[model samples]
Target: MNYMDEHILSLKNKLNYDVASNNVNTSLSQTVISEQDHSVSEKNLALRLGDELIPLELRVILDGEIEVSVPKSFSLMPLEQAKFKYPSEHRPEVIYTSEDGTVNITFNRTESTLANEELPEFVEQMADVLRSVQPIRNWLGTQVIVNHSGLSIGLIRFIAAGVDKNLYNEILLFTHAGQVMMGTFNCMESDMEAWLPVAENTVHSLHAVSLPLQSSLEKGADSL
Candidate 1:
């Protein structure tokens, strides 16, 4: 079978297993899940990414400390969600991709806060990393301030072109609550203009909510 069909089958098997284990009588339908019926906790902050009624999937990590909302048009994979590597630890929180596979978005969080002044150096390091993997055609990086969900956020926008003629764009942001978010969008050089804005808006829609330590502990206990 093709990859898409295999992916859909895998998702169905997972959902069926979850339902059977949970003893929930809900019927399993299509692989794509609706936003309203997502399984994430209600305590998590809501993030709206444009008005598109695209099918979405939700992923929670770090004992509900981090949440990610991804469109079903893209494939989703859960990651370890840890900064430092330990045995059996996954690095990224989640990953998404567009239907064509040329576009990709990765969502990750670090425990430490990222300072605005340090972004340029970080981008430089990233640029070096990208060059090591692929030949670079051009690179640009800039910082911007964004207001979303009543929070003033420091954002870094990085754009580059690889010798393969693919365009890459990434948005890095840090929250006052000491959470770092990174979203990378990639597409063909010719399609960059049309897809860049959509990627940027998706990044902008990311929202962080802070819960008291006691509340977090209580929630974790309840889940167990």
Candidate 2:
């Protein structure tokens, strides 16, 4: 089966979502993680999220990991990882399905930086489970949290909103390396809004997001 088909199946089995083959299609990985330790030139490519064309730069590490970095200005949305060949030692990309159906894809390459031929059976199963959610709509918003360590490190938690005409933008959180926590979406109109309900001070090294007055109205309008 193709990557899209396999991913759908995996999602159905894992998340209990009855996704059909026609409902899901394989798309490119939104974020690519390359390792700087490797001896490969940087590759520049364009990434499409909904309708936006994002400029992507990938640096391949000697061991087999791909270093990924996106522009600070553009909002990062959830994406599906496509099939590609790389060194074998590299850990296959991963996807997480939240209780509310938010999909998070993680390309774990802390180990070696090699891309193996085709994805292993295990990784394929994980992808299927991850994409089972109904795609995010223009008016909807989702809170995303990312954890990273090692040579490259960062923790990002932000509210992603398809604010205008499917144009998504992300409010910055404590987007730094090491351990970090932050919150962004606090409005009532979001499609599936939830928060990390812990003490604010305990978020010692946390990123805090402000709910501007204008943003409140925008969110309200999007919901309508």
Candidate 3:
């Protein structure tokens, strides 16, 4: 199955959501990426969240077809480790995770064709689907932001009931090259206050770049 399909199955089996996939955990690591770490050839991408002051890094990932600012401490999740952390045979296409596998930022490119103006209503429709599928979840509503490139990004937040603990789930939807990209930021429900802004800023920092078709989003390192 494709990444999105498997992700949706994992969502249903683990996080009590409807037709979407992603998860999060506890404790943010303290590994800093400083100015000295960046080369002159790259754009300096960074952000600080709350009193914790976690640093962000510029990463061209998914076979180097997309540019995103993620926490400096995040790493691509290993396949073996992903199985237990996500508790599913299916998971997101690219998963950048914490040391303990509790928190995550995931990306999955879907075949859906989306237009710029349709993002807000599309996000609402997703919310309605989740509501009908799991009304017991703590509903935290949704928001829409247009990136610097005028791409509309849809953000949905909620507290999801998990088998062991609750998770603060944020679902992001946007399009690039007229195709949908579903990304997610998740952390422990208890850590929502500290991680929420990190998630938001990370989404704001998202932008795409051109690349050869051979190094496209269609393929990438499954684990690291």
lDDT of each: 0.43, 0.27, 0.65
**Candidate 1 lDDT, 52-98, residue by residue in tens:** 44544444544565444555456753234222221223234454655
* Alpha-carbon deviation at 43 in model 1, angstroms: 18
Better of 2 and 3 by lDDT: 3
- Runs of candidate 3 with Cα error greater than 4 angstroms are 1-54, 86-89, 211-224
lDDT per residue, candidate 2, 175-220, as tens digits?
Answer: 2222111122222123222212111111221222335789899999
Off by over 4 Å in 2: 1-65, 72-106, 110-120, 128-224
For each of the candidates, the C-alpha root-mean-square deviation to the true structure, in angstroms, is: 14.8, 20.7, 8.0
**Which wins on TM-score, candidate 1 or candidate 2?**
1
How many clashes (backbone N, Cα, C below 3 Å) per candidate? 1, 21, 5
Report the lDDT tens digits of candidate 3 across residue range 62-134: 6666788777767998888766555654466778986677678888776566666776777776666666675
lDDT of 1 at 74: 65
Worst 10 residues of 1 by lDDT: 20-29
Between which residue pairs do clashes occur in model 3? 24-186, 24-187, 25-102, 25-187, 25-188
**RMSD to the native, candidate 1?**
14.8
Positional deviation of residue 196's Cα in model 3 after best superposition, in angstroms: 1.7
